[model samples]
Target: MGAFLLAWDPGGALAARIGVVNVQQVLTQSVAGKEATQNLEKEKVRLQGLLRGKKEELDKFAKEAQNLQLEIEQKGAIWREEERTRKTTDLRRRQRDLAREQDEMKRLLEESQRDLTERQRQAVTQIVKELRDIVHQLGRDDKFDLILDSTASGVLFATPSSNITEKVLQLYDRKKKK
Candidate 1:
């Protein structure tokens, strides 16, 4: 890179302050990240509970339909024609209701899961944007001419003095607190 730069310009390159950030590490270890993770987990659990309840209700409905079917099988032979027809109609109605309810439940679950995923994505995007801004702010304050995200950049080597993940994380946490 230095050779390429030298080839491009006759004059020698000038000294520039450079900093690197392990963005993934900062996001995982930072206070705001932890809080966001916890909140998402809690929401996930709550949604799981709601889906579980809906499943339980469906299961109960299914069991009731099964019992009615067995009753029709056992007692249907001895009943009058009209009574048999009424019981058969009732059983079919129950089956249809169960299928409809199951479909509705599936739709609700899918919609909820999609919403949760989108929310998570939005939250991460917002955090990344904020982190980017903070990185620029810190770079300016510290007189860094360049700041690179090691997680995304192809940077393979950086000195300890150039690594500023901790400082950025600390500043991020502080700003979030405010």
Candidate 2:
């Protein structure tokens, strides 16, 4: 114990200060991140409305086809053969139309989801890049020996005094505004 104390370099220990930051907080609190979230939400709502409209149109077609089928079943005994055949053909055509429209709707929904996901990914990448730059600058300006992302760094415990999340957020917002 005595030899260890005597050999210890106090200067090195004092120079190595650790800091923690919650990256999730920074991403959610940053102005640019908020804007991206809002944009994504707006796009989601638009897509949902479009899908709803398509569903309603399909429902109308389904109802009409059902009514035609019922009429054929109820009156086929008295109707001429040609009339019955024509009604059956119309019902089949409506069914085919419904199937085609359903497929189109599904394709549109998948495309919209893919587009939204890509946009979200791009926005997150941009925000992360900016965040890294800000954190790097903060580390330089504040003389931080090491700054860890508590959210991803698997830091089980850290004192509040060593947390720089709020400061990082402020700096990020300021930089974004500029």
Best by TM-score: 2
Give the per-residue lDDT digits (tens) of candidate 1, residues 110-170.
9988988998888788888999999999988999989999989999999999999999999
Please list the residue runs of candidate 1 whose C-alpha ends up more than 4 Å from where it truly belongs after superposition. 1-3, 6-13
- Candidate 1 C-alpha error for residue 175, in Å: 1.2
Please write out the lDDT profile of model 2 over residues 45-110, one tens digit for every residue: 999998999999999998999999999999988999999999999999999998999899999999
* Model 1 lowest lDDT segment of ten: 6-15
Off by over 4 Å in 2: 1-15
Model 1, 74: alpha-carbon shift in Å?
2.6
Error of 1 at 47 (Å): 1.3
Query: What's each prediction's TM-score?
Result: 0.85, 0.88
